[model samples]
Target: MNGPDPSRPCLTPESPPHSRGRSCPPSDQLGNSSSSSATTPATDLDSAVQDNIFAQAPSETSSRPLPIPAANALRHLPSPPLAREACDGGARPSPQRNCCDGRPAACNHRAVSDVCASLPEKSFARHFLTSSGTFPSAAEILKKAAFFNSGNRPHDALLLCNAGLEVYAEDADLWNCKGVTLRALGRLQEALDCCREALRLDPGNTNALNNIGVALKERGELLQAVEHYRASLVANPHQPTCRTNLAVALTDLGTKLKQEKKLQAALVCYTEALTADPTYAPCYYNLGVIHAETDDPHTALQMYREATRLNPSYVEAYNNMGAVCKNLGKLEDAISFYEKALACNANYQMSLSNMAVALTDLGTQQKASEGAK
Candidate 1:
């Protein structure tokens, strides 16, 4: 399943989680196999529709992730603990890996030294991918969970994430990953809880902002969703995914306003959508529709062109463009645009009907010319 396409809206179901606890593809394997763990490329899945179908792919993970595997795999740490430590003093049980250096030998370095000297080995190694280590590292577990989340197995992903959170409760990325998995599972409230926890740990996390926004949008909380999306953009103005999401949300809001006859407010939303993401195709389409309704054929045609430029397969945009051209007395151009619409989506009835009309008009004009000659 591909990640969210910035060109579309949020939480669009990418791949159906028809099953859970499924094994991930070997391609998603993380960490090197030998002495050190290898890197597993994270898949940033879209919670919405499938990628190839081209509707709204999913909400953005990172502004960088336009779709699948959008941003750098959620904050990966080196597995197998980078360093081995033998605590001389501090606490009885060392929190560093498997080092069980009892409390700082009576609170003195000498006591700690005495204990280390008495140990059979000066250092210990915990292998992440091997049975030699009693347990997997938090990073490794999270990485595995990411793969599961990407592969349409939210159930397996949730299990791994919940397990990791228990051990690494303060990990922000871990919380973010868990949030994504929960969102994918349709556990909206639980997913929001995870994202809120992630935000508490890192208020500046754009990923969390986007994730929470997706959850909110899915729950019909448009204003809150807009708030999260707007916050994310403020945090990282350079993020394209966030910008795309904002545009999507605005477009939705605008559509609703248009239905309410709030034309001015709808215009503002459509315009703001473009401000958020200039290349957002739907925004252009909306603008075109508005301009056309206002009897501004030329401006409407321009907007439709912009939409088609951004999304070549935009059949509706093409159909609208034909209508605008026809209104402007460009019968040939109208026919061409209608044909383009049909080419993109052969079964589009609107384009087919428009094309027929355009052809009829062209035939009538030709007959008139012959009669005049």
Candidate 2:
């Protein structure tokens, strides 16, 4: 009879319980040896298929992620995580390999610390190659590199990516991953080159397009950045993060237009930005500013309401709402809005000054009413 399939569980009744149902890779495929311990080196994956392809990539694990419809630039520069299940051909990552310690509240620092501390120098490339006589697959190397990226160890991540590229030169995801790690290290030109290479390999790669946008944005090429963001959206319309990035770019561009007194063009950009992501509160706030400038207080009030609805803690929106109300001769409403702004931020000088003026106006109006009565 033929021996058991290395890709399947042992059907023999005498197989040990621990070895049963494990779906271990062929000894030649993974390494020369198998260990019962869960603490195997990152390369010695028990089953490459066991990785959770749907798990969030390291870049998606920001402690303070941008709001769904972020109007400003990203809260933090994001690194694109590994490919999804569909993109990775269903290869999933182990939980530890995907976990990040970058966010203090989200990770077990000790586990990351142990992993980093125990890692042999050039572990994936040198040690594993020497011991197993085969390089780990691109997916495996990417997982370990992602783990290091999560721990804020970009140098290690870069090392892993470079090594993987030597063996899997045509892997687009590897190039994209390396690009993001290089971007993290502030190597913008090199990062852009890698992302461009990934784009060349996979023409419709949204991650490469998005990273290219990031690099351009960093270089202060807003218009070029906008083009890349638009290209990425065309490739994957469901990407909320990319949509937010687009909105941010548009908003920034609009501000520049407004400064140049191109009011109509600025308005068009703001409208388009809101169209891109209606939940972006700052865009609404910006719309309110434009309407207020154009002598449309009522419309401005509506826009301000939308802004406050999306972000209740938006002090600027509240303050501007107070200003709009005051201009409309609604002193009481203006004071209330000012008070809300102050509650959100007691040290906001604009609201403090506006609040005092509103209170003084209310007092003066009360005195005049008493005298008339």
Candidate 3:
């Protein structure tokens, strides 16, 4: 019998887009022998690669604007670049790219899934795929889904996450991502189901718990949302986002209680929220409203001023400040604040109405002074 012929893997012209800044050398080209002799430990090599990946990661604040009100505030806000690139179809690995020589078969699906499953839980790879040189694997799909979610393409993200779940149904992170996308799409019941499934798999999943809180909050289940937010905070106390969400839920509860003549209880809730996050602007604003409603204009003015100081572009705070000034008979100051509110958001109907009232009051005062003269 003739000896088996030597098999060689055919190299394809196309490869997956590079991840982060890592590039894979072409398989056909063997580099200089001297260059290949540098032996780095596997641990060091992995650390170096990760460091380079981190270096290539974009800064989050670089793309975020001041969140000003404008004709196209939402449109002008830069989408997360990582998320945008994931769904762009530019990062996909070529199907014909062989992983090993002499075997024409591409990388197995299980191998791809395993690589994704091994990623660090809180790493950027959990939400974004680096563009250096890594090929599209199952992890890349999950990252892409996350990118879609952050980029406000929740429907697309949901589809990609669902596809990933088909291959790795037991992935708690994937279920969490699916839940987030579902919630963003307003499919609250489905989102709840997905989040519950994620929590069932990983009882300590803070992300799932936080998302469940958001879904419940949106559904007007304020108490339930508060419970979930508290649970999430218990799991990860350092999550400021969850703290903020909890504060909002508490504020909502306080508002309802206040309307029901539970002023003391409402004050307690607002005080708790402020204790949780002293610098939270909305909490201060809500506190100011509570004080104003309870006939304490001085305290209300103090809270409104603090809110505006923390967030200068907070139009509602400016409007509230104007109301406090008007009550104090500081007509000129009230007008100034109302104008500032309108400057921040030209279409603010409340500011417009208040400005008209202030103008009328000023005119009446001027006319009365003229008659007395």
Candidate 4:
């Protein structure tokens, strides 16, 4: 009872310790708190356990960088935030919705999967185009395709692009639009080819370049993705989304570098990412991780705080703050940060484990104090 109530209803591995139990003890109790009922004795072994829990940063698997999808230049939507990375030990949910379908939304809507279910793919474009003898202009067709693609009708969009291409073979926009639809449908190679064709027609096509970057990134070609993203930015520096995409690619590459223990090189990548998109929250979180790795807890805390400020629902950042605080011997602050993380995600196991460990340590320290008295 002096530490955590193991019998608490929601104290399972799947739930945070603070999800359903007594809140963390008051910070003022750090100097003196009742520990007579402490279950774990104060020993070097307890210290070792605490060290093991807080000293080692979470594994890369627990906090790998999330992939940022390339901006859909054809869709013409608002710039989306960079993808959120898992800072500590939880899977970050993707920020996409299944367009009224039951599949994972990351598939860019359920329609992308079943778009051809109702119609025959081979004749769909022919019927759609030939049926209207006086076909719309290439611009009109591209507009309609974009509308359909944005409306989650990627199959219809693809057909429109195909029919339009038959008439307007040299239209770069049509090819780019088709590439977007194909990518949405999981046809990465075809999508890449289409985007390449668009680029061939218009050598400076920003949309096609960005889409190609996306396809390449998906294909695990990070360096190529970065190159294309940079080219997209060079074509039109005003594109905020492209800037974000560049930052994301850099962060991803930096994460790989960090995993490889190339700390200085990784730092350069992260710094460049910040330069690319100053407001990107995940970049800040990644910076915090790097600073923490370099034994700079204060800087790490600031970076984590900035990340949480920019994105309040960042459970991983909060969990990491708690871990850093615990390592710095700020047990009260660590518990508070863990509580904040649990507030964001009640089922965050890392924060739960960390909170329990911090509470146990606090209890042991109090017991030691009383015995000394």
lDDT of 4 at 72: 24
Best by lDDT: 4
User: On residues 245-308, what C-alpha lDDT tens digit does candidate 3 reach at each position?
Assistant: 5665665566567657788997888788677657656556667766776678799789878877
What's the residue-level lDDT of 45 in candidate 3? Answer: 20
Per-residue alpha-carbon lDDT of candidate 1 for residues 1-373, written as tens digits (9 for 90 to 100): 8753321111101111111112222111111100111222234433211111001122221011123331211110000110000000111111322211221111222332333333334222111222343345555555566556545566666665565555556666567767766655556698789878877766766667766775665555657877987897787676555566666666656656765778899899878877987876656766776677677778878877886786676666676677667767788988888888778779766556667767877898999999999
lDDT (tens digit, per residue) of candidate 4 on 102-206: 222122133322333444656644445445654455555555565454444668777777766665566666677687778667687998898888788767767
By summed lDDT, the worst window of 10 consecutive residues in model 4 runs over 29-38
Q: For each candidate, how many residue pairs have backbone atoms clashing (under 3 Å)?
A: 22, 4, 12, 0
The segments of candidate 4 whose C-alpha lies over 4 angstroms from its true place after superposition are 1-133
When 2 and 4 are scored with lDDT, the better candidate is: 4
lDDT of 3: 0.51
TM-score order, best first, reads 4, 2, 1, 3
Q: Best candidate per TM-score, number?
A: 4
Cα lDDT of candidate 2 equals 0.54
Q: Give model 4's clash tally.
A: 0
Candidate 1, superposed: residue stretches over 4 Å from native: 1-134
Candidates' C-alpha lDDT = 0.51, 0.54, 0.51, 0.55
List model 2 lDDT by residue over 1-373, tens digit each.
7763432211101111112212222211110001110112122223322221111111111111132110001121110111111111222122322112221112223333333334566664345434554446666666666555544466777777776666566666677778767766767799789888877866766767866776675565768977997897787786665666666556556655765779889788878877777776656666776677678879988987997797676666677778778767898998899889879879766667677777887898999999999
